[model samples]
Target: MIRLIWTLSAHTRYYLRRYMPTNRLLDEIRRRRNLKWGIPAMLLAVPYLLIASICTNALDQGAPGWLHLVVLWSVWNAMKLIIMGPVSLLLLVRARIAEAVARRGGRRDSDAGESVNHAGAEPLLHR
Candidate 1:
């Protein structure tokens, strides 16, 4: 069952990737997602959520049933963008800290009272 779902998703992605006109822009966004550009990308969710809200209003006004699909797709994309913002921020922070550490002679911090054992070279605490 899960395999079937996975295969279906793969095929759907294949077709979408092949036909989507904005594939290049999406690829660029994905490539730079962990950079400063990602923070502003979170704002893209606002438009999606607005679209979903508009479609939902239309549905309430007796729009066609198929409008639900647009609402669903908009909400889902908004959620993905919203989530990616904070995650990318965290990743950026970690990358910056690693770069800073590397610049500072790349010495890993160790407690002053810790001793390394010869057998495993693992640290042993004084306590």
Candidate 2:
């Protein structure tokens, strides 16, 4: 049972080393890409605002009470978008930070060609 557990743990570590992204990729992408909160902010806000404006215009046409209700719905949706957009953007930023940290750690591990062990001992493995 102990051997099985050890083998599984070793395999997991090996696969993690083989597949994870290196720090170089993370650094290059982070440097090249501007994380634009404005783009996402506009994306989240603009469509709903446009729809709300159109609905308001339609309501002004004096069509019916149902159309007024539609306008109200549009306004509510717009408000929801405006409120949630920032929250979503914050979540996205956090996700990127986490990804960067993982990539950096993985790259360091790969460069050292040493798995971080519980006992802080470096073991040379045959690749």
Candidate 3:
């Protein structure tokens, strides 16, 4: 019974987190192909920061203490997005470099094979 309760609670938490506004927004951004959308996604942090600012202002204006949670959540989401942008850019650069290297390597290998075949050598397949 205890194990079942724990499992259910874990599942509930996962679904809750998955559907959170910030997570949903990030999921949408990452759904695009090739991580190309990530560059623009960096701009999303601005709205989160603005939300935090607004909540903070509300708190100062004698709003409910619950607004503190909103401010913290907004700031956390903003920081996540800010950090994701630079990390995604680095990943994109690394991918491009690897692709370029692979292309050059493939071409060099093909050229070397052609030269060997033209040097009057028996084809490896027939041998």
lDDT of all predictions: 0.72, 0.59, 0.82
User: How far in Å is the alpha carbon of 67 misplaced in model 2?
Assistant: 2.1
Q: Report the lDDT tens digits of candidate 3 across residue range 1-127.
A: 9999999999998996698876676666554354676767778889989999999999999999999998998899888788777777777777788889999999999999999999999888999
Quote the lDDT for 7 in model 1: 100
If scored against the real structure, what TM-score would every candidate get?
0.64, 0.43, 0.73
The window of 10 residues in a row where model 2 has the poorest summed lDDT is 23-32
Tens digit per residue, CA lDDT, model 2, 27-102? 2223324334423443545665677677777767865667667667656655654554455456568778999999
For each of the candidates, the C-alpha root-mean-square deviation to the true structure, in angstroms, is: 9.4, 17.4, 3.8
| Winner by lDDT between candidate 3 and candidate 1 | 3
Provide the clashing-pair count of each candidate structure: 0, 0, 0
Candidate 1 lDDT tens digits, 1-127:
9999999999999987777533433444555433666667778889989999999999999999999999998887788777766766776788878788886643443432233454456554643
Q: Lowest lDDT 10-mer window, candidate 1?
A: 106-115
Output the lDDT of residue 73, model 3. 85
